[model samples]
Target: MSTVIAYVDGFNLYYGMRAKYGHRYYWLDLAALVRRVRPQDSLVGVRYFTAPVRGEPAAAANQSVYLDALAAHSPAEVETVLGRFAAKRLRCKTCRGPLTCACTPPVSHRTYEEKATDVAIGARLVEDSALRASDVALIVSADTDLVPAIEAAQRLDPARAIYMALPPGHMRPSRHFSTVGYFNINESALRACQLPALVKDAVSGAVYARPAKWH
Candidate 1:
């Protein structure tokens, strides 16, 4: 039996689900979702990597509840990686006209926040490889930032199998990175893992309808 381990890019998958099914489907059981994809006699463990909510007290509390539920269902199966939000500055080309226009910092700087998840993911991959814990690795992310880490893993174990699970709406692989094979999680899979109505948000009383089809 081949030992399989799954590595999920938290923000990539979360936004992907939101984009495909809207915020209503936010309550997802990731381990259950992956089990649907596992082949018999091949799965050994599943790993999920994601950062916690940065702001918004209500949203954070909701996320914490969901995380607890996930852990309760699969105590040893799920592994979470924490990432921090960092702010970045961007300059608008239109704001500064052509060469004649003087460029001055806007009265209010534009701040964009993003989660730092790549480094932590790469480190974990290396750690797993060192322990020889798995025979095959399944990476669920579309970010090319992981190219180097993937390559390193292959170098460490030439026969190691590597696969990718691209988020919905992704049609092409990154030019900088490619995988031996890829799987796209479509609407059907998303719907299959949709949370039930009872545990749905109690505040807004929102409930998600399952997708009509299954993948």
Candidate 2:
């Protein structure tokens, strides 16, 4: 059986799921999801890339709980890679106009951009390919920014297969993801692969309950 390493784009998957199904699929089992996506392969591990929410305490807390649950799940090996959020302040174009202008003044607001995620994924993908970590690299994301990295990995070793799986109800995913194969992920699989309502840390023995917002 081919060995597979599943790379998950945490925000991409989360936003896609939220857009389509609210929080119905938020409580997920990474291992079970990977197995459902590729039942024929041996899942070596799952790398989930995401950044913590900076401003919303409730949302941040929810994210923490979910990550903890994933950590507690022993059936599937998962590694969490945290990125960062870049907050920038800028004035609106309209507000930058001349003082004599009758139009409303430009408003300055802070915007948060998710940083280092795609770059990290790309780098990790190439590094793993070069190291021959697995026969197949399964990236569960529709981000086209990864195209270049995917290309580099394939060039490193043409025999290394790169598989892509899009989130359920995802629309307009990149068509260039079929280098070697595609993994099927749907709402049914997500619904069936949910983690238990309460999970205990495999090592720490602390119990984590599913966030009520997620339920």
Candidate 3:
């Protein structure tokens, strides 16, 4: 039996699903989804990378519920790794332009940028390969930064197969990811692999319900 581990990029996967299919698939079962995607292999583990919402309280609550549900249901198969965001200031493009205008006023806004997710995924990918934890690494993302990690994993263990599973609606992957074989996630599979409306933690007896907005 071939051992397989899946690396999930939470932000990429969330945006892709919402953009392509809307919020219907937000309650996805990661292990079930991976099983549908790769039925031939034995799924050993799944690593999910994401960061908390900064300003949106409702969205943050929904995210917490979903993550808790995943943990409550598939505690043994899935692991959630959190990243952080850094706030940065951005100036208006009109303020700094080639053409000088009298009405060009200074405008700036603070925005948060996701940090450490790609690095975390890369580190896990390479580490797993080095440890021979799985015969195959199924990376679910379109991020270009992970290419070097995939390449390094292949170099570290020539026998381990690393494959890229692009999120929905992402047709073009970076040139760096071309060397690795790819697969496009289908909406039908996602539709079939959804978490239940309610889940309870066996140990703590804490219940997690699906968010109403996701309905």
Per-candidate clashes, comma-separated:
0, 1, 0
Error of 1 at 78 (Å): 0.6
Q: Mind giving the per-residue lDDT tens digits that candidate 3 earns over 1-215? A: 78899999999999999999889999999999999988999999999999997867898899999999999999999999999988866655878524323554934456788999999999999999999999989999999999889989999888998888899988867788867888899889888999988899999999998888887
Q: Please identify model 3 stretches exceeding 4 Å from their true place.
A: 96-108
lDDT of 1 by residue, 1-215 (tens): 77788888888887877777666556666766676666543666677777667555666666676665555555577776667766555555878632332446434344446666887777777677767778878888888888888888877776778778888767666876654577787667766775553344444554433333211
Deviation in angstroms for 5 in model 2? 0.2
Q: How much lDDT does each candidate structure score?
A: 0.69, 0.85, 0.90
Q: Mind giving the per-residue lDDT tens digits that candidate 2 earns over 142-213?
A: 888998999999999788888878876655456766565665578899999999999998778899999988
Model 2, backbone clash pairs (residues 3+ apart or across chains), number: 1
The TM-score obtained by model 2 is: 0.89
Ranking by TM-score: 3, 2, 1
At residue 102, candidate 1 shows an lDDT of 42
Model 1, position 194: C-alpha lDDT score: 51
**Candidate 2 residue spans exceeding 4 A from truth:** 93-108, 178-180
User: Where in model 1 is the C-alpha error above 4 Å?
Assistant: 88-112, 195-215
Best candidate (score: lDDT): 3
Query: What is the TM-score of each predicted model, taking all chains together?
Result: 0.77, 0.89, 0.92
What lDDT is obtained when candidate 3 is compared to the true structure?
A: 0.90
